[model samples]
Target: TVQALLRESDNYIPQVEKIKYEVGNGTFVDDGGIYIRWINDIVRYGMYASKTFQRRDILGVYSGLVTRQLTDLEYAWEFNYLVDVKDEEDKKIRVCIDAKHMGNYMRFANHRDTNQNGDQLYVVYNDLWHVLYIAQAEIKLHEQIFVNYGQGYWENKKKYDF
Candidate 1:
């Protein structure tokens, strides 16, 4: 039902300011800039904080192509980047953002079975849905940004041997 898929409108442009980070010793020292690093051979890549971030700090936006379709190629691995979200309406509709091809560094954030350091918030602006990351705990420098991707995602991963 590609016809049912809605295209995002560019008419509503939000005036977002760029976040600045203080560099010290070749790394971000303040405001907690984030970066992607190699976690391990199994986990592959993961996101890390450059500085300390207190609980409830706004980390960043989880930007990507909003879609609902899961193609065969995506099912093999890109499926891991698919995140479910709710629309802004009286009756919410479940949708997902495919971050495989198009997304910011937030896509590198890894999943944690326990002790999640970050949480996702579905915020609505001008009827458009956006995923914002909030620090659930005190995230220190060089710490992994762990998010609970939920049980549903794990179950799907197991089915595909991902």
Candidate 2:
């Protein structure tokens, strides 16, 4: 069905007509070698040349991702941790992160720890999602935390003396 439609469309016009138009307009040569002369003209001069000009907004909206705003601290924490999950290729999973969404996750008790005078603390939890296993773990910010995923220790916090 699609093949038939494509054949009938202007883009898939008969080869004979296409060749004639090309030849007559000097788009094609007959020196034992066919050279496209009107290629630039065809691309530059046209009312219905591209689909983008016809449906730019629809294309933009379709390409955009739908996101929900977060209003709770707990939800924010979960969202933050989940957002850290990245592909092995280091690509971000979320298409976009809004301020509200970030704020929700910022409410985590350990999101950014500070002292009485707002001095940054030495202890911090940096959780990351493993792409292959889809598991989350917390690693100490300034310390090395060994994770034993095979042993089912996802969030086991052990101090590394070394």
Candidate 3:
């Protein structure tokens, strides 16, 4: 199956960005890093890119525990995605990925209002179970990456404690 594996890895690239963090009142003196911080329970997470990314560049991929879905309802997890997979019996099964236990650097990125600039990245290949965070704009050095959580997510959720 070497050929098959190589075919899949070809679909992805060497991850271009690294996920980093800072603490309260700490000066962001470090160079070539991305940072995430929490203030009074509000996530002020930001990504400081060490390299620039062109539009449509794959930022990162989301991978985690895949389990059977309990209908179309969103699964309870900080970062996750839903997709369908075929069972051994050739039947379709809706799956909910619990990314809380496993994910890449993009998991640390913040969520922005869709109308703002959340579209910077998006989830792709839902059915294939490989969710990618693609850059929607020309990202410059020292910029943060954000993705739209969508109205469906906002309508039923409170993102943080303010």
Candidate 4:
């Protein structure tokens, strides 16, 4: 009975192959054509592509639970996950995708100066902005996926003088 239950759960698992043609969330995909790998002593883990991706291919959505801005300085680096968006009144405000505890594979993407992929923030009908990572160039298999976390991210960490 336990094995049968597990087999049924597989049906709900996200798969990249079943993704829609549009550039939205990738079937809530995780562990698709990507994997988490050890980097080095400095950079702990990084996400790498397991298959070649053409330019502008939708990788997956940076899916997470949305919440208001977090002011905890201890976890300031997580601020990179926060996105600025306009509210219903058209006033700009910061919204955070609290992905630390719950999120898809996109959270493992590291920062790169010349990243092969870039993220596009899209606002759905719910007015929540979702971060969508797309291939900036033709990326071969095994290449690391990186996105520019923006200048503000580094500026917040004065020690990261780059």
Candidate of highest TM-score: 1
Scored by Cα lDDT, where does model 4 land? 0.60
Write one digit per residue (lDDT tens) for candidate 4, span 1-162.
Answer: 434633432442332224432326543334478788998766778888999888767677676667665544222223223334566998876667666666777877877766447454332323333456677788789988887766666765643323
Please, what's the RMSD in Å of model 2?
27.2
Q: Cα lDDT of model 1 overall? A: 0.62
> How accurate locally is residue 140 in candidate 2, as Cα lDDT from 0 to 100?
21
The collision pairs in model 4 are none
Q: Please list the residue runs of candidate 4 whose C-alpha ends up more than 4 Å from where it truly belongs after superposition.
A: 1-31, 71-93, 123-126, 158-162
- Report each candidate's C-alpha RMSD, comma-separated, in the order given: 9.6, 27.2, 9.4, 11.8
Per residue, candidate 1 scores C-alpha lDDT tens digits across 46-128 of: 89999888997777777777666633222112222333444465444445677777777787887777789998655445556
Which candidate wins on lDDT? 1
Q: What is the lDDT of residue 115 in candidate 3?
A: 28
Ranking by TM-score: 1, 4, 3, 2
Candidate-wise lDDT, in order: 0.62, 0.24, 0.49, 0.60
In order of lDDT, best first, we have: 1, 4, 3, 2
User: Comparing candidate 1 with candidate 3, which one achieves the higher TM-score?
Assistant: 1
Clash count, one per candidate: 0, 2, 0, 0
Taking all chains together, the TM-score of candidate 2 against the true structure is 0.13
Candidate 3 C-alpha RMSD relative to the actual structure: 9.4
Q: Tell me the tens digit of each residue's lDDT in model 2 across 1-162.
A: 434533333232233344447867988643221111222432221111112112111101001112334342122112232235355798755422233343211111121121211111111112211111101232222221111222122245432321
Question: What TM-score do all the candidates reach, one by one?
Answer: 0.65, 0.13, 0.55, 0.64
